[model samples]
Target: MLLEDMLNHQTKIPTEWHTSIRKVGQKFDSAAEVRLALQYYSIAKRFEYDFYHNEQRHIRVYCRFKHTHGCPWMLFASPLRNLSIMSIKNFESTHTCGQHGENAGNLRASRKFIASQIQAVLKVRSDLRAVDIKNDMLSNFSIKINYSKAYESMVHATNTGSRVVIDADDRRFRRLFISYNAYIEGFIARCRPLLFLDGTFIKDRYRGILLSATGENPYQPPHRLIVISDADKGIRATIEEFFPDAFHSRCVLHLVENFKKNMKDFGHKTNVATTLDELLQSAAYKFTISE
Candidate 1:
């Protein structure tokens, strides 16, 4: 009734297929060859493949149906020394049992392949929810993935999409930021030479100061914002280290706050503090440097 049934009875086997065991000694330059071989074998035998040993240089796959009791239908392959091409080293064709069923060796859930597909989806829609992702996978690929696996895939995809660099420790986190090629390119092309630096406190589980640098784009109305963490030295040191030649300016709001705090510490009365704040604001809005 099935291909495996026909093959087990010594019925005629197709010799035209490229994936026949007769093609074993053939050379391959990528892991795709091994996958193709496994797919072809699974289709012929109606059994799934479970990898026992999968690595960069070597691979060992066994029949999932008989893998627990040690089925002899195994496939082994490795790359050639001093060459990139991979060749099959050994293969066992005899199975101790009949075919399992259709959809036996589906590889849509493989870690590497799934991670890559998730990354592609995240690149376009970074806000996609994990539950939605799981639903989409089921609807599109007929692959039912658990919530944890989908969440892990989403996190992996997000990290891959946004290249976040960090310096931290168990006690405290020092610095963290996202830097991508497109952001860098847009900043260089559209933003002005002047940079405004500022920092604010984040009210989160792990409270930390969020330092940001903003620049005005000549062709665009929106400011290009880049978030870079301040090392122990301070925001000035961090900005200077990265943008040594750029013209830096302090935020007027921070300047006013510091001035007000200093005035208050000097025992200034309410009237005096209010007057000083107005004077500071007026000075900040002056049109000429001499004013």
Candidate 2:
């Protein structure tokens, strides 16, 4: 399923999750904990705030519009008894401005906040794309975020003690090639004189069109080395230039697809293309020079 759709299909809240009740004298283990609760409150309530004062011992925040609108809403928390045990010293939960959905952009929908919100989805679908997360937030919650934030959000959500690593320089999913040494070694040992090259479109998140080369040795004696692939000019040129002695051939599957495409463009019936494709495939496999 698409990540955006998967996100919309919600699940029951886990036991570890809990909503915060902002009240005076309410204590938290640390200032980070208190800020997280405030973050939850701001996003859920669709409001925004600015940190007026944030220190090791204390943290204070006022409405983001406090300066322009003269809003008086503010909250303050500080270490009460233990240095790390923070307690809410003051909580004024009132907003003068119309806290609309647009406020759920910028600071309100921080990357960390985005990470926390999508962490559950990541657990189930690690291959979830950043764009899908961005779409889900906008469509469902009216939150606007950039692609970089979405990408970093996934990294932060999955990187802690996890192996899913994302390296982004300009905040884009770049090219990649995957191979296994054991498979390569096995192919070499088998001494297959034919190599099959193919590319498949990746539909999943971070799935890019990638070309792969592999060989399988048949029981028959080796002839001149042959390379087969879909008719990509780059592959064709490389094969002809590098291995001049080897014979290069187009993959049979690509030829079949091309035939179907040409028939489709000419307004041929579906069965006509299918019948022709079957005929071509049968002719290719049915007879050999020995026969």
Best by TM-score: 2
Clashing pairs in 2: none
**162-205 in candidate 1: lDDT tens per residue?**
34445657635577665554555666787754455557899998
**CA RMSD (A), model 2:** 14.2
lDDT accuracy of residue 252 in candidate 1: 65
lDDT string, candidate 2, 1-291, tens digits: 243233233243221222473578889988888877876666555567888757766899888888888778898888976467998899886667654344442476777778888999888887899899998777756577877677767766765322233445676656533344456566656656888999889899866786678887754555788898888999888988999999899788898889889988999899998898888777667668653
Q: Residue 226: error of model 1 in Å?
A: 13
**Clash count in backbone of candidate 2:** 0
Per-model TM against the reference: 0.45, 0.48
Per lDDT, the best of the predicted structures is: 2
RMSD of each: 9.9, 14.2
Worst 10 residues of 1 by lDDT: 9-18
What is the lDDT, from 0 to 100, of the residue 132 in candidate 1? 86
